[model samples]
Target: MPKIEEAQPKYLQIAHHIRDQILRGDLRPGDEVPSERQLASSWKVSRPTAARSLEALSHQGLVEKRQGSGTYVRSLEVNRRARELYGRAKQTGKIYTPGEYAVITSAGWLEAPDYVAEALGLAVGARAVHRRRVTNNDSGPITLSTSWFGPEVGERAPKLRDPDRIREGTLMYVESVTGRQGSYAEDRMCARSSTDDEAADLDLAPGAAVLIVHHVVYDLQDRPLEFAEATYPPERWAFEQGYPIV
Candidate 1:
């Protein structure tokens, strides 16, 4: 398998680093970014590479370049889109968003719940690997996510059963171990009251309005490889997307 860094262009790697810093609040809005010369020197890359990194960030609306000045972090207050999140994960080989991290609250084999069983095409009460996590950023917990995998995936990737973060993200690691490349995904979302457990993990009052997203990833052969459910506080989080309707 190719190293994660080797799979991404050098410029994108630099851009991701800066983007992470900004999202983590290490580089706040309006802060002047390092010059191309400085970045090239620091990263041991060409000036053009450094320039492209900044340009990429600018195109994403995460930074602004001022004439005669330099690139600076932009002030952004926008909804987090699921598509963007997945794209970033695919690019960076990381499931956690920039500046966000997760704590694996639980990981082990469990009887697949009805919904999970249906999603994974397993019989009800069938054995599966279940991993629960709470993702947080600087403010506080942002989401509570639970992922279910078929037993064979657990057998192939033992790390899924460990109560530890998967550095390459679960699906990516599974692909690496089982040679099942993810081809597409399906997502279903709803707005509803948070359950007791979800409320506790998200630090919200029970019955608070929350957004629930169910995601299923399929391998190249169109077999479901992972089923995930994520809960978010509607007031603090949202999924957005834009497209031209012609």
Candidate 2:
């Protein structure tokens, strides 16, 4: 069989490989990562590409470089429990995990932001249904999630416009109402300073570091059904998953 190729740049592939090791606990905190030359030799890539891989990890706050010392794993806080939470929600009609609850801060029809509009294939500044919520555990707020849908979805699923929690979970509720099952989802993530609104919702000081995930769920037709932005306060949440190597 022909070998399947990765679409990501070689540097990113290297970075992701290292990241997986970290998340899998194969590389614990303070453990030294392979040197750039070693990575180049192992991955059969240029030294520049290997160095870029480490740089990418540093930007994600996954590793740190020391003077005269090689890079080291800086954190092992990444957990796969977040995925479990969603999976349980889908199966049990519960939106949150044990010891977690959410407050619906706002829910109504509003003009979608340009990015959200684009994700939902709507014109710029088009009106959409917006639902904002903050999930909290005993430790305090963990995530601030804002979900957007086209106006038509809101009209069909009127409960989406209410502040009450959807006992069936939003995704399931949408599927029930619209007959549009979520076929797949895409996530784009970045680390950046929290906005004032996000900081307030997540109970962090303004300008604090945050991990933002832009998530879009698509129907069988590959049309986006919902666009959500989930913001996590620094040091509070991380995502980890393992997959088979080809």
Largest TM-score belongs to which candidate?
A: 1
After superposition of all CA atoms, the RMSD between model 1 and the true structure is 6.8
The lDDT of each candidate is: 0.80, 0.80
Q: Please report the TM-score between candidate 2 and the true structure.
A: 0.67
- Which consecutive 10 residues in model 2 have the weakest lDDT in total? 76-85
lDDT (tens digit, per residue) of candidate 2 on 53-162 = 89988987889999898999995444323334456566556755555688999999999999999999999979999999998866788788899999889899999999
| Clashing pairs counted in every model | 0, 0
lDDT of 1 by residue, 76-175 (tens): 6433434445555676666555567889999999999899999999988899999998878777888788999998898999999999888877777888
The C-alpha TM-scores of every prediction are 0.70, 0.67
Which pairs of residues collide in model 2? Answer: none
